[model samples]
Target: MQLALSTLGCPDWDLERILSVGRDAGYDGVDFRGYRDEIDVTRHPLFTDRADETRSRLESAGLSISALSSSITLCETDDRAAHVAEARRLVEVGDTFDVDRIRVFGGGDPEDRSRAELARAGGETMREILSIDGAENFQWVLEMHDAWTASDDCQQLLDELPADNVGVLWDAAHTIRLADETPRETLDALGDRIEYVHLKDAVYEPDHNDATDDGYVYAVPGEGDLPMADVVAALRERGYDGWLVFEHEKRWHPSIADPDVALPAFVEWFRDQR
Candidate 1:
């Protein structure tokens, strides 16, 4: 598996710093979530106006863009057109970066609707997004996030979508923490459609004592009980050679370790695993 780090980890870093540090840290690629204060890469000047320069810079740094992690939520009832347009725009940006995968979120509350309903919503939105010309060439990856952390729920969403380009972005932490699935079980169930993996670690604290409302606190790779090693072993056993993205959520949670401390640490830990 190749290693990549999400720009979500270092939201304050500019594009040059991101590529330079990532290259030096032995990262094979970067999962572009944001750069500096810009939350949307497609709108950012580096990607929109200076796209060619950005690509050249990335190439010069010896790094590829593994994926463009967008905030397009499919299961939401609000602004469906905006969601589809955003996804289409991201696909356009993906083309510019030679990126084949675009990360999206399966966001909704299970308590508000059945998993099937959520899946249907996600499927419909995905179908609409895929209808755009050239959109089918890119994999619109649905991340295991929000209420779709459960493999079965994610499977339900996949079942509703018939397009082969739609795939899963397996976030190991969520499936384990929220759905109570072991690494092997998650891979066994969603292995076929998983196109990318988000590597994060955290421990469950039932008393809501952590940064997360659900009591899950972020930990550097291998420091928490996330079964990351087992997950990697399962992927290898399945002959999966995809991007293993280290998703450090420092942007949303400022209390977490800075990227300066967390980024190289992940590279060392990942290399040790090899």
Candidate 2:
């Protein structure tokens, strides 16, 4: 698997710093979750008006824009038009960089609506987004997050979407931490539908903690309890040669290790495994 760094790891850095850090750390690419203060990076000038310049910078840094991580939630029933617009904008940004994958979230509270209802809504929403002109140029990968942490739950939603261009962005940590699933079980269920991955490690703390309310504190890849080794082995066994984006959530959790430290640590650890 190729290694990449998520800008979500270093929210304070500008594009130049992001490219520099990623290059020096030996990453093959950078996943754009956001840039600096812009959570929706498509709105940022670097991705909008100056996208070509940004692409040139990436090329010079010897890194590719692996994927554009959008905040487009697939399950929300309200603001359908807004969601479609956001997806369209993302497509434009992605096209400029020649990146063919966009990350989306299965975001809805399951307690408010049943998994079946959310899955139906998400599928419908994704279909509309895919119908947009030029949407077919990219593969939309729904992340295993929020209400869709379980492999079976994701499969129910994936069943409604197109198998060829729509797939799962397998976040192994979520399956293990939230759904109590092993890496092998998640791989078996999702299989080839997993088009990309979000690599992170976490320690499960049953009690409330500073890192998260969900009992999982983000850790540097090898320093946590997330069965990351098993995840890698499972992916290798399946012949999954895809981007493993180190999703260090330093943007949200300021107390965590800085990207400068955590990013290289992940590269070293993952390379050692290989």
Instruction: Give the residue spans of candidate 2 off by over 4 A.
Output: 205-209
Q: Return the lDDT, model 2, position 4.
A: 91
At residue 170, candidate 2 shows an lDDT of 90
Compared with the true structure, model 2 gives a TM-score of 0.96
Q: Each candidate's TM vs. the true structure?
A: 0.95, 0.96
Checking candidate 1 for backbone clashes, the offending pairs are none
Best by TM-score: 2
